[model samples]
Target: MKIDLTQDMIDQGLTCPVGKRKIEYCDAKEVPGLYVLVTSSASANSSYYLRWKQHGKTKHTRIARVTDITLAEARSRALTLRREIATGNLTEEREQKRKQQMTYSDLFEEYVTYKRPFKRSIGKDIQFYNLRIKARFGSRLLSSISRHDLQKFQADLIKEELSEATADLYLRLLKHSMSLAEQWEYIEKSPGKGLKLFNPDNAVENHLSKEELKRLVDVLMSDENRPVCQIVLWLLSTGARLNEALKARWEHIDRNKRQWTIPATNAKSKRSRVVPLNDTAMGILEQLETEGQHETLWVNAKTGKRYTTIQKVWQRLRLKAGLPHFRLHDARHSFAAMVANDGTTSLYAIGTLLGHKSNVSTRRYAKYSSDTLQSISNHASDVIQDAMNGDT
Candidate 1:
């Protein structure tokens, strides 16, 4: 039903008829399909909308609130919308504009929600966003972000004394987020395309020597550092990541088969792998099995809880062992180095033992694998000896 709506009618208030209280809309008398939408609250002002049928489908578009626009203005806007609908152009243009206006904060929120359930590193991503990305670019429109803005951001991070690697990580996260935005069509294109990453200084690869390993082992064997000792030993033996070892559970281990399974959730690569337990790794598990009543394989004897970190204890232990500074990750490197140095093991075998997802990562230890080099040298020496003896 259509009724001529005036300012007085709007100001004095128009109520839905008693029998039509369930209806949400009342149409205008002059403008067909133009409506004043009513709500359940009597005090609430009605809003203007246009509802029309085109090609057997209903299209509803909001005009404005009663307080914001006069009836004449609503009629004018509704007429324009009607023309656009007849021409078949308004809806897609309106939605495209809305997507082009999406801001960094908007995309980040959606990204976090989509990633939280599936991504293991989302916590770190959130930390990176909060600490660095949010404050500078959170409110900025995604379409407005440019290569220059990213370059400036990189310079700012460097000026703040962030290491090149850390600064690159921030840029990488931004690039990744923007890439997602592009994939989701929140932005037309990724602005981070063709951005050059900062070249980080060469990192020192620390591998413990036999003497140093002995000293470190002795220090770890002390009563106070036993929990950390066992953890480090496991790390050394299996070449598993620190977190993988810390979070190991008895259920994931098959002692009789001499295998320990690192669940995909607990692993960096998000792929579950079975690590063959060496004699040393098996021994540590057996000792812990006898001592631990809980389901977790590695736990603090004193607290009977999983060990979160051993950084503090490790720092002091390394100092007492008279070893040069080395991170806990270096233990994994040392394991790879030891295996690679053994004359029989191939780099592929070493990579398999370390549970590396790709051979590219395993290639870093090639320079440290003396076995291959030794074999090449021995072959050359044999050729030279054969020439000297006129055997060839």
Candidate 2:
């Protein structure tokens, strides 16, 4: 039977037929493909169903019970579902359920647990996530994070007075985490798939010039920020990264060999590297020993905690040194440049000293090698003189 669905019509209920009709259905006149199904005698409940012909096949789904929903609501819902049926968008409920699967925080905790076994920079990763990424995406669902969202985030990071390298590092971690989400089927695809790292050009290293280095030394001698300055001194002395120097433990130092061993957990390369210490580095260690006997190499006296970042210390020192743009990582470059220009050290020796795992990374200092520069200058002088003499 067919009728315009109404509260009064539904309230009256269906009349019984003479013979045993197993069931009865009435299609609503106001809305197409909407019907009420009544079971014969066996069941007292009735249900509203939405039916549609899709892709040459008949499909139907239960909307709601007649008792559970009002007649107006059933018709309104039926109208929406019918439009969606024509558009083949019937799986919106499944999409909503997918969005509730996992949050970025949940994924981050799981990713960290998976990575802590072998990732040397896991601590840095967690720190960056907490500082930069968590506020934006921590509670957001894995399935809901879109490429545009991450792109905007990447844009915001660069505008926040952070270096391009720092911003890129933040995105690099996100790219890997989201890639894992895609691989694990938590998300349909990684939103960071197309995100680009805005790697700064001519940014391989930013070593200090001799004049700037002298000024920095002057400020280091004058500054009262001893704890942070100590880390800066360690970095300048051994070319050790800030993290490697900050996390240095007393046990990792070989007093006899005058060598500092960076464990795989603290080493950025994920392998134990031995940094040979000079008198300058050894002297700093000796000075630190007089302060305390703790396993940690450097602790902030004010906080009594292991150092995380020397950014503020650097900001003050940079202004004082009049090298306002110099970054803490530049200390490593300055140390490498110092060694490279000594006229005796080879590129291979420079790489080993800095504990660089790759030769390509050490090659950036080729121009700084005095031997290489002097040899090139001699070649040019000989070529011009010889050519001038040859004509005579």
lDDT of 2 at 52: 69
lDDT of 2 by residue, 1-392 (tens): 67666788777775445565544355546888888777565233466777767556665566665666777888899999888766768754553465467799999987886677556679999999999799999999887899999999988987897888888899999999998676445677899997888878656567888888889888886788877777888899999988899888888888899999998788776678899999988888777742345668887777777788889779988999898778898899999999888878899999988888899898888989867688879989998999899953
TM-score of structure candidate 2: 0.51
**Which candidate has the highest TM-score of all?**
1
Q: Alpha-carbon error at 233 in model 1, in Å?
A: 1.7
- The 0-to-1 C-alpha lDDT of every candidate, in the order given, reads 0.81, 0.80
Model 1 earns a TM-score of 0.70
Off by over 4 Å in 1: 1-90, 199-204, 221-225, 289-292, 377-392
What is candidate 1's lDDT per residue for 235-272, written digit by digit as tens? 88889899998888888888789998999889888789
Candidate 2 structure lDDT: 0.80
